[model samples]
Target: MGVPFEDFKFNRQILNAIADAGYTEATPIQQKAIPPILNGQDVMGIAQTGTGKTAAYVLPLIMKLKYAQGENPRALIVSPTRELAMQIEENIKTFAKYTDLRVVVLYGGLGPKTQIEQVNRGVDIIVTTPGRFMDIYLAGHIVTKTLQVLVLDEADKMMDMGFMPQINRILEVVPVKRQNLLFSATMSDKVHSLSANFLEFPTVIEVTPQATPAQTVNQHLYFVPNVKTKINLLKKLLDAEDDVKKLIIFCKTRTSAEDVYKFLLRKYGENGVKVLHANKGQNTRINSINAFKADEVKILVATDVAARGIDVSDVSHVINFDVPVVIEDYVHRIGRTGRAYQSGEAITFCTPAEEYYLDKIQKLIKQTIPVSDIPADVFVEATGFDERQEQAREIDLQKRKENPDFKGAFHEKKTLTQRKKFDAAKAKKTGQQTDKRNKSPKAYRKKR
Candidate 1:
């Protein structure tokens, strides 16, 4: 009942496409961003994932470039990852369905022969990753002169992935007169610099505060003792909630992701669970995401690589199997659930060491996560000695990062247990063996 899609000044072709996509209402981002975009203003949109941010810019881009014109692309969208590039391509196709516009997606991890062929045929809009786009452009396959509009989606993620050099190179090639749109869920210092350099007194649109989780998401935290107890808590929570029809459990590493996937596979059967990580083949990752989106898979175990771009509906919950070492990734991981104005749950499991990161995440998001009591029925496994030592070491490192003056716990303990100075000068002068601790202080002082 907010602003409807028809209220926007879209053409019949776009209107029909929107209707066919079953999108009746305009999300907050769409409502605020579309008009400025349609006016051809350089806009910087700040919105969270699943707030219909992709379509917010895509719709206006399609409206501006109504039909196919030449062999080269008129507009370009540079995404941080291949998954996001593919998602943007799908959105463009969905909205530009009625028009004769030709759009193609280019990404690495596969041969570019097909993409090069698509461009040769005729492409009005190109959606691609920064690295692959640069690769094709350097090879003389892309025409920068034809690009009238350029969008950098998930600019923060791109910055995190170290795509700034390529982005700068792209800026150098593209015409400066063209419209520039940059969108991101969070605004880091790097993003601010990019905006200052890239945008030309542009209008800034922020639907939500930077790094804030969506209002639709209810978050919970649990302090788990060890990896074994974390798994137990995960099982207990899943077994208790029948409403968790679809969920994603995010781990920090590929090994942990695989282990969680295997555990879920045993519990839910092969067809019910899938795993996605960088190590998985591109086709396998695509299929896994597609299945999850289609509701064919009830669970997806993934690393942070899958966190930024994969958008699935009705995700009942997102479980953080491990707290991300990168503080910014915390926002992206939980952003997976509670998408598209749907209410969802995000639960995080933190070990003693991970609490350091958890504190940083809370400060970034500007909110304290509610801690939930572990279920009485679940067994809380005791931490092994080695694991305990590792956790202590990690926590010490984290503390040192915060305050360089902080000598870590181990440093302090070592200082206490360190052997007293051997007093080599005294040994040389007195001709006494001072290195041995077994020699009594009285004997050493009494003389050789």
Candidate 2:
């Protein structure tokens, strides 16, 4: 057991809500972050995904803002994505269940009419994506003067999405004397810069190394030759692994996610499977996530962008249908499982073309993923000629990125063949001209 929640000296309402949520003990991040935040100190928190980071800050924020305030928000939480904003808002509501605090989540996908109305009605905490927050603030819907606490959740993701300018603007608009908090799964240079500018004499807390996977997650990798072989392997694993009760499959592209979702839908029917991607309507994505969280759906296929801020617990496994090109996302993807101290598995399928990214992921995670041999019972399909060439081309591109002077194998060979043809043509053209000149009277006389 970790540190008990009661040791922090919370009010009866917050403690009751914690008990209702079945959270008896605080995780490492919670233990370190809750105290400093409650003391009204600027804080920078670094931890991997699923480390109970949300509760670490949310619980304290609830304790501070015990009752509902005026129409304006007293606290603000900035998120990189609308999905993440909603997830944070859900956590706030879950913990603030017994309190009178009012929370509103603002995002860009839906019409602002309802969000504007929500703000007009009273709000204590505002969780919003940067763009939507700026839009509402500019439209005179948000009153930043009342804000006392400002939290930037998933700060690294905000940097990745290039929200720095909006963040700066937000810092300017909010009252300068307020408390600041920044939380991230990974601490990149960009995050460092944001922290330097966003905080002052702040408490810096890092529970684990940046981008480290949770210890509760058992990672397994398989080398797939192609898409068909990956599907074959996925089918075999799903059929054999009885423990894969709830799973999230991450695909590199929306198209791939849809294809995988369709396959799973055929097998499990509509009730068991759902797909989420940027192309999906906001309602569809939210519904898919809600269904998965409620245990109504057994599997969810999603692209990385659409999968952000998914806080579902008890997910048995996370399968990477395609290796993520963004190496940092590998941590986030696998971190979906093994949540709330539950033991879970993270299985990755790496095609030959994706091996370059797999290598990077291993390096970033500071450990090699255990490779599992394909079962003898499962058929390993042959890689097609075109697919093989594409894989080779992708590998060449990966190499080229590492060494700019390095010419790709296929392109280098084609260049040599073209050079020979060009030289031969030039020689033939000179010879033809010499022969024509010799046939002329003056040239014939000289030749004789």
Candidate 3:
């Protein structure tokens, strides 16, 4: 029955809470991880975004903490991003609804006083980002010695942002003998080494291969010319396709995310688009995310910072308006859709200069995306390839000249040896033309 809740040996209250949350079946990762976590064993879970990994740790931790019963927070969950941390805190509250357990989320970009007050209230569970958590802990506002369970959510992303040292500091303060659970969408050597340092004799659960997009996701790659052309192409694709019910447009930076959001808003009206990023205040970010989730907004443009821990299902399509700089990020960006076993589409617009990054993405995924050609009518004719190549070469030469360390060996005025080589090639071509002209008269006489 899809990994029954009863099989995990949860208390009746926890079982009732799960049923109340409208979840009877455990997800794949949850089915595998909940058992070990309930048994008080450390876990190393490898699963993609939107795979219910939150529940994999949250449910067990709730049951264990509730049963053991303490006022001070014994469980600590650290996420790489604020959105994810809030989502985890919300999920913990949802699962532990019937219990007296208190859950609070700690993140940056918000006032710390409220978070400090929550900690003072003696929360049983704490979900937070490492940076904000460390800030509070080091400021002597919160205590960590009571922490019994430690969770590093999105561990790979933590490493990506250079938060490993902060994570190490937090780990050092937590109670030495505790259950450690590390979860990441994709595991690398650095992530492995970090896991080695934290989790001891842990259970490893990898439902999907590392960095692999879901099979249900249809991926498309379009080779476009530039940013303006990409916008036009996206407009065309959106207008041409009838089934694009809801969309999440991912941008590479906050500026680009806002730009795309404004563009879409202007074209499609204010109701059509919303933007989410780190720069926004907590209330604003949460409101934007909720609006997108409730279908109040048809298109939500977001930076990679807000991409994780956004668990909205039925997202019909995800458009990479800008190709992600990190290949693994492409996996996470497109992963926003095609979740909950539903078919979804992910399209990436790759400029010529960005093709190298796209190629690396293909190599990592081990499957070449079918290149989509522009429709003949929509194709805007530009300069010839040779002319464009020549222009690019001239631009490179100009840049090198501007550099202080320009080497004379390459771009210096024609040296004697270089001139000799050029003249020799020109002379050979002239002699061939002369011979052809001579043979033309002979051939004409023979024809007569």
Clashing pairs in 1: none
Which regions of candidate 3 deviate over 4 angstroms? Answer: 67-71, 379-448
Models 1 onward score TM values of: 0.91, 0.91, 0.85
- With a 3 Å backbone cut-off (N, CA, C), the pairs that clash in candidate 3 are none
lDDT of 3 by residue, 1-448 (tens): 5888888878888899889877878889999998899898999999999789999898888878874345577889999988888888888878888888888889998889989988887788889899999899888877777888999999999999899889999988899989999999988998999988998999999999888988889999888876777777888888888898789999889988888888888888877788898788888889988988889888889999867878987899999998887788988988899887889999999776567678778988888987788766565546467745654554456456558565544354457669757755676565522235543312112335
Q: Sort by lDDT, best first: what order?
A: 2, 1, 3
**How does model 3 fare in lDDT?**
0.84
Distance from true location, Cα of 430 in model 1, Å: 21
Per-residue error at 422 for model 1, in Å?
A: 13
Candidate 1 residue spans exceeding 4 A from truth: 412-448
Candidate 2 per-residue C-alpha lDDT over 202-320 given as tens digits, one digit per residue, 9 for 90 to 100: 99999998888988999999988999888999999999989788999999999999999988888999998999899999999889999998999999999997545688888999999
**On residues 188-294, what C-alpha lDDT tens digit does candidate 1 reach at each position?**
89999999999987889999888898888999999999999999999999889989978999999999999999888889897899999999989998999999999
- Score residue 354 of candidate 2 by CA lDDT: 97
RMSD score of candidate 3 (Å):
11.0
Q: What is the lDDT of residue 130 in candidate 2?
A: 96
Q: Which 10 consecutive positions of candidate 2 have the poorest summed lDDT?
A: 437-446
Candidate 1 root-mean-square deviation in Å: 4.0
